[model samples]
Target: MAADTTPPALQDFLTWRLHRLAKLTDRQSSDAYTQVFALGVGEARCLAAIGQFAPLSVKDLAAQANLDKAQASRAAQMLVDRELVLKSASETDARGVVLTLTRSGRPLWKRVMRLIEQRNADIFGCLTKAEQRQLEAVFDRLIAHADARPQGSSPATP
Candidate 1:
Protein backbone atom coordinates (compact mmCIF):
# COMPACT_ATOMS: atom_id res chain seq x y z
CA MET A 1 0.00 0.00 0.00
CA ALA A 2 1.12 3.63 -0.65
CA ALA A 3 2.10 5.77 2.33
CA ASP A 4 -0.72 7.87 3.80
CA THR A 5 -0.93 11.37 2.34
CA THR A 6 -3.58 12.99 4.56
CA PRO A 7 -2.54 16.14 6.39
CA PRO A 8 -2.71 16.06 10.17
CA ALA A 9 -5.08 18.47 11.90
CA LEU A 10 -3.82 20.65 14.75
CA GLN A 11 -6.17 18.90 17.17
CA ASP A 12 -4.43 15.63 16.38
CA PHE A 13 -1.34 16.83 18.25
CA LEU A 14 -1.38 16.45 22.03
CA THR A 15 1.24 19.20 22.48
CA TRP A 16 -0.92 21.63 20.55
CA ARG A 17 -3.92 20.87 22.71
CA LEU A 18 -1.89 21.38 25.88
CA HIS A 19 -0.52 24.66 24.50
CA ARG A 20 -4.01 25.89 23.71
CA LEU A 21 -5.22 25.06 27.19
CA ALA A 22 -2.20 26.78 28.73
CA LYS A 23 -2.83 29.88 26.66
CA LEU A 24 -6.44 30.05 27.77
CA THR A 25 -5.61 29.66 31.43
CA ASP A 26 -2.69 32.06 31.22
CA ARG A 27 -4.85 34.72 29.60
CA GLN A 28 -7.46 34.35 32.31
CA SER A 29 -4.83 34.54 35.02
CA SER A 30 -3.20 37.59 33.42
CA ASP A 31 -6.50 39.40 33.26
CA ALA A 32 -7.35 38.57 36.85
CA TYR A 33 -3.98 39.70 38.12
CA THR A 34 -4.17 42.95 36.18
CA GLN A 35 -7.70 43.73 37.32
CA VAL A 36 -7.20 42.99 41.00
CA PHE A 37 -3.57 43.89 41.63
CA ALA A 38 -2.52 45.94 38.58
CA LEU A 39 0.25 43.38 38.20
CA GLY A 40 1.52 41.46 35.22
CA VAL A 41 1.63 37.71 35.31
CA GLY A 42 5.42 37.72 35.58
CA GLU A 43 5.36 40.15 38.49
CA ALA A 44 2.66 38.21 40.27
CA ARG A 45 4.45 34.96 39.73
CA CYS A 46 7.69 36.45 41.03
CA LEU A 47 5.94 37.86 44.08
CA ALA A 48 4.26 34.57 44.87
CA ALA A 49 7.49 32.67 44.45
CA ILE A 50 9.46 35.06 46.58
CA GLY A 51 6.80 35.11 49.26
CA GLN A 52 6.52 31.36 49.41
CA PHE A 53 10.22 30.74 49.01
CA ALA A 54 11.91 33.73 50.47
CA PRO A 55 15.65 34.21 50.58
CA LEU A 56 15.82 32.75 47.12
CA SER A 57 18.54 33.74 44.74
CA VAL A 58 17.58 35.03 41.30
CA LYS A 59 18.40 31.60 39.90
CA ASP A 60 16.20 29.93 42.48
CA LEU A 61 13.46 32.48 41.91
CA ALA A 62 13.53 31.72 38.19
CA ALA A 63 13.10 28.02 38.91
CA GLN A 64 10.42 28.51 41.55
CA ALA A 65 8.43 30.92 39.40
CA ASN A 66 8.78 28.76 36.31
CA LEU A 67 10.32 31.74 34.57
CA ASP A 68 13.56 32.31 32.74
CA LYS A 69 16.37 34.11 34.51
CA ALA A 70 15.90 37.33 32.58
CA GLN A 71 12.20 37.52 33.34
CA ALA A 72 12.79 36.76 36.98
CA SER A 73 15.52 39.38 37.17
CA ARG A 74 13.34 42.04 35.61
CA ALA A 75 10.38 41.24 37.84
CA ALA A 76 12.62 41.22 40.90
CA GLN A 77 13.94 44.64 39.96
CA MET A 78 10.43 45.98 39.51
CA LEU A 79 9.45 44.67 42.91
CA VAL A 80 12.51 46.25 44.42
CA ASP A 81 11.69 49.53 42.72
CA ARG A 82 8.17 49.35 44.17
CA GLU A 83 9.65 48.64 47.61
CA LEU A 84 7.73 45.37 47.68
CA VAL A 85 10.83 43.20 47.63
CA LEU A 86 14.23 43.68 49.15
CA LYS A 87 17.28 42.42 47.29
CA SER A 88 20.38 41.81 49.28
CA ALA A 89 23.67 40.29 48.39
CA SER A 90 23.87 36.65 49.20
CA GLU A 91 26.33 35.72 51.90
CA THR A 92 26.98 32.34 50.39
CA ASP A 93 27.24 33.49 46.79
CA ALA A 94 29.21 36.66 46.33
CA ARG A 95 27.80 37.30 42.87
CA GLY A 96 24.21 36.45 43.65
CA VAL A 97 21.45 38.18 45.57
CA VAL A 98 18.62 36.97 47.79
CA LEU A 99 15.03 38.14 47.49
CA THR A 100 12.59 38.67 50.35
CA LEU A 101 9.22 40.34 50.62
CA THR A 102 8.98 43.59 52.53
CA ARG A 103 6.52 44.16 55.36
CA SER A 104 4.07 45.83 53.00
CA GLY A 105 4.62 43.09 50.45
CA ARG A 106 3.44 40.49 52.94
CA PRO A 107 -0.15 41.71 52.72
CA LEU A 108 0.02 41.81 48.92
CA TRP A 109 1.51 38.33 48.94
CA LYS A 110 -1.49 37.05 50.87
CA ARG A 111 -3.82 38.61 48.35
CA VAL A 112 -1.91 37.13 45.45
CA MET A 113 -2.03 33.70 47.02
CA ARG A 114 -5.77 33.99 47.61
CA LEU A 115 -6.27 35.03 44.01
CA ILE A 116 -4.24 32.08 42.79
CA GLU A 117 -6.27 29.70 44.92
CA GLN A 118 -9.49 31.15 43.60
CA ARG A 119 -8.34 30.95 40.00
CA ASN A 120 -7.30 27.34 40.40
CA ALA A 121 -10.68 26.49 41.87
CA ASP A 122 -12.53 28.30 39.15
CA ILE A 123 -10.55 26.72 36.34
CA PHE A 124 -10.86 23.17 37.63
CA GLY A 125 -14.43 23.52 38.89
CA CYS A 126 -15.81 21.71 35.86
CA LEU A 127 -14.10 18.52 36.85
CA THR A 128 -15.32 16.18 39.56
CA LYS A 129 -13.07 15.79 42.58
CA ALA A 130 -12.00 12.32 41.50
CA GLU A 131 -11.33 13.51 38.00
CA GLN A 132 -9.32 16.42 39.33
CA ARG A 133 -7.25 14.08 41.45
CA GLN A 134 -6.68 11.80 38.49
CA LEU A 135 -5.72 14.72 36.28
CA GLU A 136 -3.26 15.99 38.87
CA ALA A 137 -1.65 12.59 39.11
CA VAL A 138 -1.43 12.35 35.35
CA PHE A 139 0.15 15.79 35.12
CA ASP A 140 2.66 14.88 37.82
CA ARG A 141 3.68 11.75 35.99
CA LEU A 142 3.97 13.56 32.66
CA ILE A 143 6.08 16.30 34.18
CA ALA A 144 8.35 13.75 35.83
CA HIS A 145 8.75 11.88 32.58
CA ALA A 146 9.52 15.06 30.66
CA ASP A 147 12.08 16.05 33.25
CA ALA A 148 13.75 12.68 33.03
CA ARG A 149 14.19 12.97 29.28
CA PRO A 150 17.16 14.80 27.88
CA GLN A 151 16.48 18.08 26.18
CA GLY A 152 16.38 18.06 22.36
CA SER A 153 16.13 14.30 22.32
CA SER A 154 14.25 12.63 19.50
CA PRO A 155 10.75 11.37 20.24
CA ALA A 156 10.48 7.67 20.93
CA THR A 157 9.27 5.55 18.05
CA PRO A 158 5.92 3.85 18.34
Candidate 2:
Protein backbone atom coordinates (compact mmCIF):
# COMPACT_ATOMS: atom_id res chain seq x y z
CA MET A 1 0.00 0.00 0.00
CA ALA A 2 1.17 3.48 -0.76
CA ALA A 3 1.88 5.64 2.26
CA ASP A 4 -0.48 8.53 2.93
CA THR A 5 1.95 11.28 2.16
CA THR A 6 -0.77 13.91 2.47
CA PRO A 7 -0.96 13.65 6.25
CA PRO A 8 1.33 16.50 7.22
CA ALA A 9 0.11 16.19 10.78
CA LEU A 10 1.21 12.58 11.03
CA GLN A 11 4.64 13.44 9.67
CA ASP A 12 4.94 16.26 12.18
CA PHE A 13 3.93 14.05 15.07
CA LEU A 14 6.45 11.39 14.04
CA THR A 15 9.21 13.95 13.74
CA TRP A 16 8.47 15.32 17.20
CA ARG A 17 8.41 11.84 18.70
CA LEU A 18 11.74 10.99 17.06
CA HIS A 19 13.38 14.08 18.51
CA ARG A 20 11.92 13.40 21.94
CA LEU A 21 13.21 9.84 21.91
CA ALA A 22 16.63 11.00 20.77
CA LYS A 23 16.85 13.46 23.62
CA LEU A 24 15.73 10.88 26.15
CA THR A 25 18.26 8.38 24.82
CA ASP A 26 21.06 10.93 24.89
CA ARG A 27 20.30 11.78 28.49
CA GLN A 28 20.25 8.14 29.53
CA SER A 29 23.50 7.32 27.74
CA SER A 30 25.34 10.32 29.15
CA ASP A 31 24.08 9.64 32.64
CA ALA A 32 25.20 6.02 32.49
CA TYR A 33 28.45 6.57 30.61
CA THR A 34 30.66 6.91 33.69
CA GLN A 35 29.04 3.94 35.36
CA VAL A 36 29.17 1.75 32.31
CA PHE A 37 32.16 1.50 29.93
CA ALA A 38 32.12 5.19 29.12
CA LEU A 39 30.44 3.71 26.11
CA GLY A 40 28.72 5.88 23.58
CA VAL A 41 25.06 5.44 22.67
CA GLY A 42 25.74 2.79 20.03
CA GLU A 43 27.79 0.68 22.45
CA ALA A 44 25.00 0.72 25.01
CA ARG A 45 22.59 -0.41 22.31
CA CYS A 46 24.97 -3.19 21.31
CA LEU A 47 25.14 -4.37 24.92
CA ALA A 48 21.36 -4.46 25.22
CA ALA A 49 21.04 -6.36 21.97
CA ILE A 50 23.57 -8.90 23.18
CA GLY A 51 21.63 -9.29 26.42
CA GLN A 52 18.38 -9.81 24.58
CA PHE A 53 19.74 -12.06 21.84
CA ALA A 54 22.63 -14.01 23.21
CA PRO A 55 24.29 -16.90 21.33
CA LEU A 56 23.82 -14.94 18.11
CA SER A 57 26.47 -14.62 15.42
CA VAL A 58 28.08 -11.30 14.56
CA LYS A 59 26.02 -10.86 11.38
CA ASP A 60 22.76 -11.78 13.10
CA LEU A 61 23.57 -9.63 16.10
CA ALA A 62 24.31 -6.63 13.90
CA ALA A 63 21.02 -7.02 12.07
CA GLN A 64 19.14 -7.43 15.34
CA ALA A 65 20.76 -4.33 16.80
CA ASN A 66 20.36 -2.26 13.60
CA LEU A 67 24.15 -1.89 13.54
CA ASP A 68 26.67 -2.49 10.80
CA LYS A 69 29.02 -5.47 10.83
CA ALA A 70 32.04 -3.40 11.80
CA GLN A 71 30.38 -1.70 14.73
CA ALA A 72 28.89 -4.93 16.01
CA SER A 73 32.20 -6.75 15.62
CA ARG A 74 34.01 -4.00 17.49
CA ALA A 75 31.42 -3.95 20.24
CA ALA A 76 31.52 -7.71 20.55
CA GLN A 77 35.31 -7.66 20.99
CA MET A 78 35.08 -4.80 23.46
CA LEU A 79 32.48 -6.71 25.44
CA VAL A 80 34.72 -9.75 25.48
CA ASP A 81 37.66 -7.67 26.68
CA ARG A 82 35.49 -6.21 29.43
CA GLU A 83 34.56 -9.75 30.52
CA LEU A 84 30.94 -8.98 29.81
CA VAL A 85 30.45 -11.27 26.81
CA LEU A 86 32.01 -14.37 25.36
CA LYS A 87 32.77 -15.09 21.74
CA SER A 88 33.29 -18.56 20.34
CA ALA A 89 33.65 -19.99 16.86
CA SER A 90 30.38 -21.27 15.45
CA GLU A 91 30.19 -25.03 15.22
CA THR A 92 28.14 -24.92 12.06
CA ASP A 93 30.36 -22.42 10.30
CA ALA A 94 33.99 -22.30 11.23
CA ARG A 95 34.37 -18.73 10.00
CA GLY A 96 31.36 -17.51 11.97
CA VAL A 97 31.41 -16.49 15.63
CA VAL A 98 28.69 -16.30 18.25
CA LEU A 99 28.51 -14.01 21.27
CA THR A 100 26.89 -14.37 24.69
CA LEU A 101 27.06 -12.79 28.09
CA THR A 102 29.60 -14.11 30.59
CA ARG A 103 28.85 -15.27 34.12
CA SER A 104 30.00 -11.98 35.63
CA GLY A 105 27.63 -9.90 33.49
CA ARG A 106 24.42 -11.33 34.93
CA PRO A 107 24.09 -8.83 37.76
CA LEU A 108 24.98 -5.85 35.59
CA TRP A 109 22.40 -6.87 33.00
CA LYS A 110 19.70 -7.11 35.63
CA ARG A 111 20.62 -3.71 37.04
CA VAL A 112 20.46 -2.09 33.62
CA MET A 113 17.07 -3.61 32.89
CA ARG A 114 15.63 -2.39 36.18
CA LEU A 115 16.94 1.12 35.59
CA ILE A 116 15.49 1.28 32.11
CA GLU A 117 12.15 -0.08 33.28
CA GLN A 118 11.93 2.58 35.93
CA ARG A 119 12.67 5.29 33.37
CA ASN A 120 10.03 3.96 31.00
CA ALA A 121 7.46 3.89 33.77
CA ASP A 122 8.33 7.43 34.78
CA ILE A 123 8.00 8.64 31.20
CA PHE A 124 4.62 7.07 30.47
CA GLY A 125 3.08 6.93 33.94
CA CYS A 126 1.35 10.29 33.68
CA LEU A 127 -0.72 9.26 30.67
CA THR A 128 -4.30 8.22 31.36
CA LYS A 129 -5.77 4.94 30.10
CA ALA A 130 -7.19 6.58 27.00
CA GLU A 131 -3.98 8.40 26.32
CA GLN A 132 -2.00 5.20 26.65
CA ARG A 133 -4.33 3.50 24.18
CA GLN A 134 -3.93 6.37 21.75
CA LEU A 135 -0.17 6.23 22.14
CA GLU A 136 -0.14 2.52 21.30
CA ALA A 137 -2.28 3.07 18.27
CA VAL A 138 -0.02 5.84 17.06
CA PHE A 139 3.08 3.73 17.65
CA ASP A 140 1.56 0.84 15.69
CA ARG A 141 0.76 3.13 12.82
CA LEU A 142 4.33 4.44 12.84
CA ILE A 143 5.74 0.92 12.80
CA ALA A 144 3.49 -0.01 9.89
CA HIS A 145 4.71 2.97 7.97
CA ALA A 146 8.30 2.04 8.78
CA ASP A 147 7.79 -1.53 7.63
CA ALA A 148 6.40 -0.33 4.34
CA ARG A 149 9.38 1.87 3.70
CA PRO A 150 12.35 0.56 1.74
CA GLN A 151 15.37 -0.84 3.55
CA GLY A 152 18.58 1.30 3.88
CA SER A 153 16.38 4.36 4.20
CA SER A 154 16.29 6.08 7.59
CA PRO A 155 13.34 8.02 9.00
CA ALA A 156 15.68 10.52 10.56
CA THR A 157 17.55 12.09 7.68
CA PRO A 158 20.96 13.41 8.61
Best lDDT goes to which candidate? 1
List residue ranges in candidate 1 displaced over 4 A: 156-158
Could you give me the TM-score of model 2 versus the true structure? Answer: 0.72
Give the alpha-carbon lDDT of every model.
0.96, 0.77
Return the TM-score for each candidate structure.
Answer: 0.93, 0.72
lDDT of 1: 0.96
lDDT of 2 by residue, 76-158 (tens): 78878888888898999989998888888666667666666766676778999799889989989988998899988866866
RMSD of each: 1.6, 6.2
